[model samples]
Target: MRTVYSEDHRLHDGKHELLEGQFMKVHESPSRADIVIGRVRSAGLGEIIAPQEFGLEPILKVHDEGLVRFLENAWDDWAATGRTFDALPHVWPVPGLSRGALGRRLSDCIDGKLGYYAIDAGTPIMSGTWAAVRASANVALTAQKLVATGEKSAFALCRPPGHHAGSDFYGGYCFLNNAGIAAQAFRDQGARRIAILDVDYHHGNGTQQMFYERGDVLTISLHADPEQEFPYFIGYADEIGAGAGEGYHMNLPLPWGTDWQGYSAALDRAMKRIEQYGAEALIVSLGLDTFEHDPISRFKLAEADYQRLGQRIAWADLPTLFVMEGGYAVEALGVNTVNVLMGFEQR
Candidate 1:
């Protein structure tokens, strides 16, 4: 598997993120990508290629235009206010707040816009956010193109991981949905049926929302149950796609402390669903955060277990593109992540 990466990912490096009622160092650090890439090289996991310059055109297909424009200008807009130390939203327009009635356009206040577009306060915007985010999307798109052109499998080592961001909302340290964008690009390129298997520790709410109303792309995610997880909203097994997408969407929520035995059972079920769907291609929202020591994650799959995870994925035997997502155990991130890719190859 050829791994696609970008040094430009360092651009979106943040200082701190608001979590657990205090601002602490961001877990989604540049070193996370560095460690993973270094492991890829150390393990000789194929050549590492730079991503092609796919501009916002492909991204716009999976995101809202105004949201895109907002992300583009968010940093500078916040900086203009002269209180910049890593911009985080302080307020949100949720539910019955009359302040939310400032109209659907969102008030001109930059703070309000930040909250309006953001799903949580944990994803802070830095100076290089937009540039880095665009680059990350390009990386995913490039990998998808390679798989479509007949590469057996490709890994998009995207940073500031996506999957948390919906069409107009960004959070969970995700600025854009890389897996979502790639799946849509696959459809645009005439892939009749493609399935996204998001094995991240967190639910791919954004990816689910993007395809929840469509049947062309089947989206499935196995993650920490929403009731007890960070997103704390969707991801229930009951959210089986809507309308034309009915039964096309699936969510297998696992409890905290789930080990390999528990995880594999869910993986088996997910693979079976994809097989039944008869997908031509697969987009694995690869996240190694479910590791036993992941800082903010709860699953307990150990290091060697990742290889088994990948081997199982290889069983599906479909053209696959692995788009990097969450996994905050920076030290072990590489070993676990590359293990999955290598496992798939060895199979």
Candidate 2:
């Protein structure tokens, strides 16, 4: 499998994020990609290439213009206020607030804009955030192009992992919704239908929201139950898409301590669904955070289990593009992530 990577991902490195009532070192660090790429090299996973600059046109397909513009200028806007620290949102326009025309006026301030477009405070904006996020999206697009052409599979080693971002909001350490962008790219490149299988420990709330009302792309995620995990609002079995997308989206919310036995069952069901849907291509939101020792996630998938996970995904028998997502167990990240690719190749 060819792997698409970008050094620009290091540019968006953040210092701290608000978590557990206090600001602490961010878990979504630059080293996450560094470690994963290192493993890919050591394991002889295949060629590692730089991403082609697809520009903002491909990104605008799934992200909102306002959100994109905000990310591009957020750091400078915040810096103008005389603060050099990482920018985190302090407030949000919650349920009762006016999200209409007046809300647009409220976002005139940098702080208000941060709150206006962010879902949580964990994702911090730094000076290089825009560059890094743009590069990350390009990484995903390059890999998608590879599969769309002729490659059997490709890995988009994206950073600031994008499964948590929505069309107009950014959070969960994500900014551009890389997988959603790639899935949309597949659609734009003439694929009649695409399936995105999210194996991240956390639900792909952003990806779900992007494709929830569309039937062309089938999004299936197997993650920790939202009630017991982050992004506690959606990702339930009940959210099986809407309108034209009805019966196309599926959420397999597992429990916190779920092991391979439980996870594999869900994977089996997801594969069956993909087969039934007759997708032309597949995109795996590959997140290694489901590992047993991940710091910020809960799941009992062991290192060796990742190979099995990969094999099962390969069984789906569709052209696949694996877009990197969450995984905070820094030391073991590479091995676990490559295990999936290696397994796919072996299959």
Q: Number of clashes in every candidate structure?
A: 0, 0
Off by over 4 Å in 1: 99-105
* Candidate 2 lDDT tens digits, 1-347: 99999999999889998887887999999999999999999888899999998889989998899999999999999999999999999988876676576454456899999998999999999999999999999999999999999999999999979999999999999999999999999999899999999999999999999999999999999999999988999999999999999999999999989999999999999999999999999999999999999998879999999999999889988999999999999999999999999998874
Could you give candidate 1's per-residue lDDT for residues 1-347 as a string of tens digits? Answer: 89999999999888888887887999998999999999999999999999999888888998999899999999999999997689999887766664344434486989889978998888989899998999999999999999999999999999879999899889999999999999989999999999999999999999999899989999999999998997888899999998999999999999999999999999999999999999999999998899999999999999999999899999999999999999988889999999999999983
TM of each candidate vs. truth: 0.98, 0.98
Please report how far candidate 1 places residue 246 from its true position, in Å: 0.8
Model 2's lDDT to the true fold? 0.93
Q: For residue 243, what is the lDDT in candidate 2?
A: 96
Cα lDDT, model 2, residue 6 = 97
* Candidate 2 residue runs with Cα over 4 Å from true position: 99-106
